[model samples]
Target: MTDDVRNIVLGVIAAGVSATLGWFTRSYLWRRRLRRKQAFFGLPENSECLLVVNRDPGTDGAVHRHDVFALLELSSIVKDCSAHVQILSHDVGRQGYGEHAEFCVGGPGSNRRTAAHLATLLPGVRINTDPEPGEDRAAFQLGSDRYRLETGVAEYVLLARLTGSQDSRPVFLFCGQRAIANQAATRYLARNHEKLARRHRTHSFVLLLKVVNSQAYGPDVVEVIGDVTRTAQTPPPAPDPETD
Candidate 1:
């Protein structure tokens, strides 16, 4: 080959080798950074948790309220452990009303801890829905109040009965929809009923509420119950004697 041709071939080969090395170096650094971050967060090297939130299906715009509950649940699970966690929220209907609202009302600080912990484990959390704004405050207020008055208190009483035993786990509260008209009743139900049950010193029950439509609500609630029950089966960490 002529001198010029040889020079051109050498340059091309050099460029290809340089590109390959750069790519490998970048991949290694990226992985190392990820490992360091995970270590700092104290996340388990390879386990995962699933977090879900329910959302209103009616609206076309804005972050749906259901996400609030999902985030809270995610936060709670991750508090002080390291595990890969996946957060999911179930979306049902246009009204944008469902179980998540109930979940959001209580335990704000504890919820945040769950979310922070999960963030360390998962790549990222997300909601599954298309955005749409629905009904005005008046409608939500009316519905919320009525639901509360009608079943809110009664529901809580039942929950308390179920959870008040010594066998009870920590009850994570969840709701299917906001009972605007029945706010007092609902709040009373959630607090009083659950509280009374807890006093029994039986089982610990963590109540999780997800807002859902009338037709499908029962099944959805059952599903959440199943998950909580399963989680409860996992032996809790030994209590710190110092704290006790």
Candidate 2:
């Protein structure tokens, strides 16, 4: 073979090797990310997850449009992990709670299951279901810290993750003051799961998420107010023996 011909052949082989390596590298990184997400969510591949759908309280058992959007976001996350999502209503049977990987949405006023979880799992977290005239509908009171609704400007939600004894999988609670806030909380979860995993791995946690500019952004703008794990789980202040 001529010298030029041999050089040309070698160049083609080198290009093929480079392309193959690139493909393998991308595949490896994608798998690694998938594994991390699965671990963080306590969901294995092909696992089953329960989606408890919340309905509008005064309506004819119909879900709010914003709440439906929230569920769609959650469904995409589950599908990404190759998991199956089984949707159930907020009024599921007792066998539900902690029996499987779950995502329970809405506030105590709307979802009875969410109310039960707040009463049982995070006992200290208090939400006012009934309000006097001119009072906020769902005011969250944890010790001295109070979160009230401000309509379009700002809204609050408590996003929590906990594993139950009945099932090894985690239950994500998306408790919000309003339907738009629920969508915002789920959006934040989808965007920040990786960061959240790094912060708390396989451990239960609760965060206060604030939705800013909901009218303009439509749940796209969210910020983590703070971590309320301890306060939500227990009273903020208890008299120590020494103090007592």
Candidate 3:
């Protein structure tokens, strides 16, 4: 073969090798970022994160069965992260959460800390308990979209993530009018976190999920009903400059 042709062939092969390596590097970095993002919720290795839940006084301070089941599933999900998990009730959560990432389980009526944090962080999304006449469930008013829990067949839950400032730690909220629905919400987050993270880049969003045949399958089946993050941005009560 002529020297000119040989040199051209070598150049082409080198360019192809370089392009292949660049693509692999980009793919690796993207996957790593996703793992880190998903790990922030008490899933990262050596992460010091808290898992907050509410206890029913009627049940003698015992965690509800649904909450317990959700916790178990969460444990498995983050097992690889080897997160240092600390379980606390909403009562103490107000003072307990520091700079560490956290998972708040249950709704406002049930978990006080979750209510207060969400109110301060996401004031636009209000959880309303006033059931419609002849109806048995509550609704969430986000911007113009009013998300209500379906009666009989489907129930709804709210899964929210929050980070106010650049230095602020992340907080994940799993809530519903009923304990079972809360379980379904957490399960939904665990199952579809990748899609949620991709769609909502703000790192803060609310998901309205519908539980399917929860009575039969528990929280195993869930569907995303709505994404209220954009609408839920009701200008978080002008942050107290003093606190800032």
Best by lDDT: 2
Tens digit per residue, CA lDDT, model 2, 80-187: 999998898988635645556889999999998899889888988989888454465688898678888888878999999987663477889999988999999998
**Residue by residue across 1-244, what tens digits does model 1's lDDT show?**
9999999999999999999999999999987654543332223455443343433334442334334533543354344344555543333212211211112221111233222222222112111112233322111111112212123222211111122223221223332233221122233333344343334333333333332332434212221221233232334345678853
Pairs that collide in candidate 2 are: none
Candidate 2 has an lDDT of 0.88
Model 2 Cα RMSD, 1 decimal: 3.3
User: Where in model 1 is the C-alpha error above 4 Å?
Assistant: 50-244
Please give the range of 10 consecutive residues that has the lowest summed lDDT in model 2.
92-101
Tell me which of candidates 1 and 3 scores higher on lDDT. Answer: 3
Query: Count of backbone clashes for each model?
Result: 75, 0, 0
Ranking the candidates on TM-score from highest down gives 2, 3, 1
The C-alpha stretches of model 3 lying farther than 4 A from their native spots are 1-34, 37-43, 96-98, 129-137, 150-152, 235-244
Query: For residue 118, what is the lDDT in candidate 3?
Result: 69
* Candidate 3 Cα deviation (angstroms), residue 23: 19
